[model samples]
Target chain A: TQLLEQSPQFLSIQEGENLTVYCNSSSVFSSLQWYRQEPGEGPVLLVTVVTGGEVKKLKRLTFQFGDARKDSSLHITAAQPGDTGLYLCAAPSYNTDKLIFGTGTRLQVFP
Target chain B: SAVISQKPSRDICQRGTSLTIQCQVDSQVTMMFWYRQQPGQSLTLIATANQGSEATYESGFVIDKFPISRPNLTFSTLTVSNMSPEDSSIYLCSVSGTSAYNEQFFGPGTRLTVL
Candidate 1:
C-alpha cells in the first residue's frame, strides 16, 4: 500500500501571514488532489495536479506538484481567518476510484 | 461537477445502536466512496460502493461494521452497526469525477457521536 505523510501537523498564524504545507508519498502517482475542509463540513476540492511540475492557483492559494510526481505542496498567501481549516492531499489508489489521503495539516489563521 | 448531500447532519447515539446515513448525488456516478475522519484530522477511506455489486472495504474495515448499499447510480447508504465510542467521528460521502484527472466531490458529512 502507498502511504502519504504531511508535514507540520499543525500551523497557527496571524492573518495576512503566508504559509506552506507539504504532502509526500512513498511512491509515484498519476495525479494528486488538494482539499480544505472547514468545521462541520466535508473536504472541498481545491485543485488537482496531473503532471509533474504542475502548478495551479486559486485566489490567494497556490499548489505545486513535485517534478517526480511523488510529492506536492500548497502555499497560502496573505492568509485570512477564513483560511483556517484542515488541508489534505490525496491520490487515486493505483488507478482505482478510491482515494488515499494525507495525514493532514491543520491551519489556524487568527484575524 | 457532482453535487452531493448526506442526511442526518449530526447524531448522538447510544452504544450498541446503529445509524444509517444516506447519500444522494445530483448526477449519476460510477463509484461512490465512504470515508471517516476525526474531528480535526484527515480522511480514511472505508469502502467503495458500486451500483450493482457489493461494496469493497479497505483493510481495517469490515462489511459487518459498515454495510453499504448502492441502490442506484445516484444514491447510496452506509450503516454503522453496533456502534461504539471509537466509532464517533465524521462520515463523508464522495463521488469520483469523470475527468481525466479524476476529481472527487464530497458531501457535507455526518457527524456521529456514540455514547
Candidate 2:
C-alpha cells in the first residue's frame, strides 16, 4: 500500500506566525494535491502539484512537490485564524482514479 | 469546479441501524467516489460509482456492508448497513471532471454518529 505520512499531527500557532506541513512517501506519485477542511464541511482543494519540483501558490499558502515526486510540503505565511483547519495531502491511484489521502495535520491559529 | 452537496449533513443513529447518504453534483461527472474519515484522520476511499454499472469497492470495503448506487453522472448514494459504534465517522463524496491527477470537488460530508 502507498502511504503518505504527514508530520506534526497537531499544530497551534499564534496569528501571523509561519508554518509548514510536510507529507512524505516512499513511492513516487504522478500527482499530489493539498486540501483544507473546516468543521462540518468537506475538504476544499488548495493546489495540485503534477511535475517534479513544482511549486504553486494560493495567496498566502505555498505548496511544493519534491524533486522525486515522493514528497510534498505546504507552507503558510502569516497564518490567520481563518487558516485553522485540517490539511490533507492526497495521491491518485495509478491504475484507477481513486485518491489515497495522507495522515492529516490539524492547525489551530489563535487570534 | 463542481458544486457537490450531501444530504443529512449530520445524523445520530443507533447501532445495528442503517443510514444512506445522498450525493448530488451540479454537473455530470464520469465517476463518483465515496470516502470515510475517522475523527481527526484522513480519508479512505470506500468505492467508486459509475453510471449503469456495479460499484467497485476498495480492498477493505465490501458491497454488502456499504452498498452504493449511481443512477446517473450527477447523483449517487452510499448506505452504511448494520452500523456499529466503530462505524461513526465523516462520510464524503467526491467527483472529478478531469483525470485522476486533476482537481476533485467534494461534498459537505455526512457526519454519522453511531450510538
Candidate 3:
C-alpha cells in the first residue's frame, strides 16, 4: 500500500516557536503536496515538492523532499496563531490520477 | 487554478434523510472528485466525477450510497443517501489543477451532521 505516514498526530506550540512535520512512505513518488485545512473548510494547497533533495520556501513555511522521494518535511518558522490548522501531505496513487493523503497532523499555535 | 464553491455550507439532518451538496467551478474542468473527511482525520476519495460519464467510486464507496452527477464540466453534485450517524462528515469537491504535478483545487466543503 502507498501510505504517507505523518509524525506527531497533534501538536500545540507557543507563538514564535519553530516546528516540523514529517511525512514518510514505503513507496516512492514523483511528487508530493502539502495542504492546510481549517475547521469547516476543505484543505488548501500549500506547496508541491517535485525533485528529490529540493527545498522550497513560502514566507514562514519551508518544504523539503527526501533524496529517495519517499519522504518529505514541512517546517514552520515562528509559528503564529494563524498557522493553526490540520496539515496533510499527499501524493499520487500507484497507478491512478487520484491522490492518497497522509495520516495528518493537527497543529495549534497559541499566542 | 480554479475557484470552486459549495452550497449549503453546513446542515443538520435526521437519520435516514439524504443530503445533496452542490459544487460549481469557475472554469471548465475535465476531472472532478468527491472526498469525505471525518473529524480529525484525513481525506478519503469517494468518487471521480467526469462530465458526460459515470462516476468511478473508490473501494469502500458505492454509487448507491453516495450518488454523484456531473452534467457539465463546470458543475457537479454529490448526494449522500440514507444517512446514518456514521455518514456524518465533511464532503469536499475538487478539480484537477492545470499543472504537471498532481495538483488539485478544492471547494470550501459541506459539513453534514446526522442526528
Looking at every candidate separately, what fraction of the true A–B Cα contacts under 8 Å does it contain?
0.86, 0.78, 0.83
Which runs in model 2 stand beyond 4 Å of their true positions?
none
lDDT of 1 by residue, A3-110 (tens): 999998999999999999999987999999999999988889898999999999999999999999999999999999999999999988785767789999999999
Q: Which candidate number maximizes lDDT?
A: 3
Index of the highest-TM-score prediction: 3
| Better candidate by lDDT, 1 or 3 | 3
lDDT tens string, model 2, B15-99?
Answer: 9999999999999899899999986778888998989999998889999999999998899999999999999999999998575
lDDT of 2 by residue, A1-111 (tens): 789999889999999999999999999999999999998889998888999999999999999999999999999999999998999998886687777789999999999
Return the clash pairs for model 3, or none.
none
* DockQ, structure candidate 2: 0.79
Q: What is the TM-score of chain B alone in each candidate?
A: 0.98, 0.95, 0.98
Enumerate the candidates' DockQ scores in order: 0.84, 0.79, 0.86
- What would the per-residue lDDT of candidate 3 be over residues A1-111, giving only the tens digit for each residue? 899999989999999999999999999999999999988788999999999999999999999999999999999999999999999999988778799999999999999
| Model 2 chain B worst lDDT run, 10 consecutive residues | B96-105
How many Å off is the CA of B36 in candidate 1?
0.9
lDDT of 3 at B13: 98
Q: List per-prediction Cα lDDT, in the order shown.
A: 0.93, 0.92, 0.94
TM-score of 1: 0.97
Report, to 2 decimal places, the DockQ of model 1.
0.84
